[model samples]
Target: MSNKSSLNLEAINDFIVNWLKSYAENAKVKGFVVGISGGIDSALTSTLCAQTGFPTLCVEMPIHQAESHVNRANEHIDQLKARFSNVFNERVDLTPVFEMFKNQVSTSDNEAVLNLTLANTRARLRMTTLYYLGGLHGFLVVGTGNKIEDFGVGFYTKYGDGGVDISPIADLMKSEVRQLAAYLQVPDSILKAKPTDGLFGDDRSDEDQLGASYDELEWAMLEVEKGKKPEDFEGRKAEVLKIYKRLNSSNQHKMQAIPVCLLPDKLKLL
Candidate 1:
């Protein structure tokens, strides 16, 4: 990381906004669909999309028992629409879907994997709506993972919050995102709010799930990104190893090439 006081933020924002617009044009999408949660990541993503001048459709997909989150989501959607030319809010209640899954699965709250699965289900449901409506509106889904979350440990729901066509900010660290947000003049409230994904209730934050701050994670991720050996980060060695194992094991497919079974019938190749 460079000196915090002398970062070139304007160039970062310009690069992201330009790349976003070019990605939309190349993909033949009319716009981009972003799930705005009134949080910094979504707000920054929405602002970048709007800066591109292409249509950005914001959706609020709330499951049951999340009134507070629903209200916050609506607030951001309204604000986003006011400044953007083609911003609209679409609602798709996922209570029934969640209920169906809960009834069918034998999940216990004491089990971490079970709890994670439930949260991931919600993420996937929201992603499904975004992609569906994206197809209908001739747009693509915009993801909100930063570099720390996108790489290193992959702190995202595999194939769930991962339905993105073009990632404009995946290479950015959280600190870098803050700088870019400042350059874009994003609201102070969003910039200062604690980071969260709103997967369960308004109270659920990413820090709570990770047991550490984004800044701490960013250091470890940056080390890994720079090709540091797993054993080198002494104090963070075990912690980073745990995260690397989970992400690599769980998202094996995301990192691997598509498999094609080799057989006698398919042996002939040019």
Candidate 2:
């Protein structure tokens, strides 16, 4: 991982913008559709897509969302549309749809499981909505996941936020995402706001859920990448390393391709 100060922000920005343009051209898609969560990642992704001179749709799907989250999302979208002629936004209030979904599903006695399942349902609903809009407009569903969440800890909902046609920032660490976002002139509110999935409809943050800050997680991820073991650290460093390893191991199913049981060619012929 490169230090934020050392990253070539200009080069990175140009590369991503060109990559997005080329990919969209190759796929024969008109543009991109991104889900905006009032977070830094989405803000940056939409900005990059807009820089490609393609139509960038920023969709806000709120399902019993926090006022702060909704406000920030709107703030970013307004700023984006002001800056780029190609940027457009849509707000889809999914609270009623979510309530209807709960009405149709079985309830669980376990509070933790029920809460997690519902939170994930919120994400999947947003995913489906993005795809729906994309299908209508011949656009690709842009993903907002950064490298750490997409691969390191896999802290995203599988097939929810994880579902997308492309991920623009999946190679950048969270710190790097913030740095690049800053360079791209993303709203300061989003850059400074604590990171969250906004799935729980509460004020809980990504750190509150992950048990470690992104900076700490990034360090742990780099150490593990360099073949360092938990035994090589002490105190908080060791604890963070353990947390990173646990998440990375458990979320392998989300990070890897779906498993396939291969049978012999002869069996297939029979």
Best by lDDT: 2
Find the candidate with the highest TM-score and give its number: 2
Question: What TM-score, computed on C-alpha atoms, does each candidate reach?
Answer: 0.83, 0.98
Clashing pairs in 2: none
**Candidate 2, which segments miss by more than 4 Å at Cα?**
1-5
> What TM-score would you give candidate 2 relative to the actual structure?
0.98
**Model 2 lDDT per residue over 1-270, tens place:** 233458999999999999999999999999999999999999999999999999999999999999998999999999999999999989999999999999999999999999999999999999999999999999999999999999999999998999999999999999989889999999899999999999988899999999999999999998999999899988999999999999999999999999999998999894
* Model 2 poorest ten-residue lDDT run: 1-10
Clashing pairs in 1: none
